[model samples]
Target: MGILVFDDMKMLDVSGPAEVFSEAGRFGAEYRLTIVSVSGEPVRTSIGLRVPADAAAESAPPFDTVLVPGGDLLPGTPIDPDLTAAARRLAERAGRIASICTGAFILAAAGLLEEKRATTHWQHTTLLARSYPSLRVEPDAIYVKDGTTYTSAGVTAGIDLALALVEEDHGPDLTRDVARSLVVYMQRAGGQSQFSASLQGPAPRTPVLRLIQDMVQADPAADHSLDRLAERVRVSPRHLTRMFRSELDTTPMKYVELIRFDMAKALLDAGHSATEAATLSGFPSYESLRRTFARHLGVSPTRYRHRFTTTRPAVDATRPALPDVPGNR
Candidate 1:
C-alpha cells in the first residue's frame, strides 16, 4: 500500500486507512505501508503534525493499492501542478487508485476520473460535478467503486473505504476481525445523507418547485401522487415531473416520500412506537416503513432508534459554533 501525503491534508484521511491496514496485519496480513511526498520531505497534516515520508513519489516502487488523501486547501484553491504531476506518476505505477474525501479533487484534476463514476466529500460534490462534467458524481454514496478507481465521501468514510479494501484483499472473515478490533461497524448503516442535513437539502431555485416542496412538507400524508400534485399545481403530471427533475433532481413521488421519512424520524425521536410512526408518516403499515428504513439506512426503524437514542442534554445555547473547514468537514 502506498499513501501520498501533502501539507494541509486531513490527518485522518491518511492515518485512518493506515490504522485499518495496520490492524489487519496483526491478523497475519502482509501489507507494506509506504508514505511519500513529491520532494521526499515530511508533510504537515491538518492538525499540525509533521508526518515523515518514507520516500519520494518519483522513485517509489509500484504499489498494489495507492491512496490519495485530501487536504483542506485542495478544493477551492487551484491544485499545485507539481502535486498533480506526482499523483499522475504514482497512479501510473499502481494496480488500483483510491481517493479519500476531497482527494477526489486531485484525481479529477489529473484526468483519472474522466468518464468514470466517482464521488467526493458531500459538501463538495456539486463543485466536483460542475467542474468535471464527464464524471458521474454520486452525492449520497458512502464510497464509490469505478473499475480501478475509487472515491469516498468525507473524512471518516476513508476508514469505511479501507475496510472494504481489506475485505477485497483478504476475506470477510479477516475483515470482520479487523472491524471488531477497531470497534466500528463492518458495514455502515447509510450513505452520506444520514450524517449530513437529512432534513434539509438544497432549496428550490424557482417558486414552482418551492411550492411543490412546501406542499409535501406541509402535509406529508396528503395525496402527493404525481397526478394529484400536478392537479393541485395546475400543471400536467409530466410537466410537474420535469419541473422537479430540473430543480430538485428527483421525481415528485420520491420527494414526498423523503418528507414523510423525515416526519417518521422526528416521531421516532419523540418516543413514538415504530408502528405508530409509520402510520403517522403516511406509510401503509409497519412493514412498509421497515422496508423504507432498510432502503435508506440499511437498518430497521427499531434498530436505528436504539443506536441513536441515548439520552443527552438539549443543544447548548452558549456553545460556540463550529468553524468552517472545507475538505476537513
Candidate 2:
C-alpha cells in the first residue's frame, strides 16, 4: 500500500492505518508500506513532527492501494495542484483508493469522487457536500465504500476503515487478531453516527446557562419547559430561547431531550431495562425512547445496549466446591 503524505497532515491519519498494517505484517501478512510526498521532501505534521517521505509522487510505483490522509485545509484554501495531480495519477493506476477524514477534499479535487458516495469528518461534511455538489456525502458514516473508492470520517474512523480493508484482504480471524492486538473493536458499522449524545452537548458559556444545565441534568423528569427555565433564570422566555440557541446551538427542549437521551443510554449500558430507562430518563414512553434512539443513534435502545454493554465473566460453579473449609461451622 502507498500512503500519500503532505505537510500539515494529521499524523494519526497516516500512522493509525500504517500501524495496523505494520502489525498485520508481524502476523505473516505481506504489506509493503510506502510513504510518498509531492517532491520526496520531509513533511511536517499538524502536530509539528517531521516525517520523511520514501519517494516523490512522480516516482512512486503503482500499488495495490493508495491511501490519502487528511490535513488542515481551511475553507477557500486551494488544494495544491501538484498533490491533487499526483493523487489523480496514483488513483488511476492503483487497484483501489481511499481517503481519511478531510482527505476526501483532496480526492474530490482530483475528480476521483465525482458523483461518488463519500464522507468526511462530521464537522466538515456539510462543507464537503456544498463544495462538491456532485458527490453524495454521507454525513453519519464512520466510513463509506463506493466501488473501489473509500472515504472515512474523522480521525479515528480511519482506523476502522483500514481494519475493514484488512478484513477484506485477510479474513475474520486475522482481522480479529489485529483488532485485539490494537485493543480497538474489530469494527464500528459504517452507518453508526460519528457523534454520541454525551459528546454532542456544547459547553455552557455562562454561569446562568451552566446552572440551568446542571438543574436539567440533576432532575431530567422535572418540568424543564422554556417558561420554567426562564423563571428559574429570571429571564423572559424569548431571551432564554435566544441564549440557548446562542450558547448550545439548539433549542431548550432539544437540549433537554439530548440530556435525557444520554441519561437513558447510560442506564441501558448499565443493564437497566428499556422501559425503566425510559421512565428514569424522562421519556414520555418506551416508544419515545425507541424513536429517539433510532433518530440519533441509528439503533434501538436494546440493540445499543447489547452492542455497548460491558460484560463480566461468569463465576465457575464446579471448582471443587472450595473444600467447604469455613471457621469451625
Q: Best lDDT goes to which candidate?
A: 2
**CA-RMSD of model 1:** 11.7
Stretches of candidate 2 exceeding 4 Å from the true structure: 26-28, 197-201, 215-251, 263-286, 302-329
lDDT of 1 by residue, 147-219 (tens): 6788888899888788877766776687778888998766442243525233456878778777887887777
Kindly list the per-residue Cα lDDT of model 2 for residues 119-217, writing each as its tens digit. Answer: 999889999999999999989888888778989999899988887777667766777788789987666666667877646666887888888879988
Instruction: Write out the backbone clash pairs for model 2.
Output: none
**Local distance difference test, each candidate:** 0.79, 0.82
Reference-based lDDT, residue 286, model 1: 93
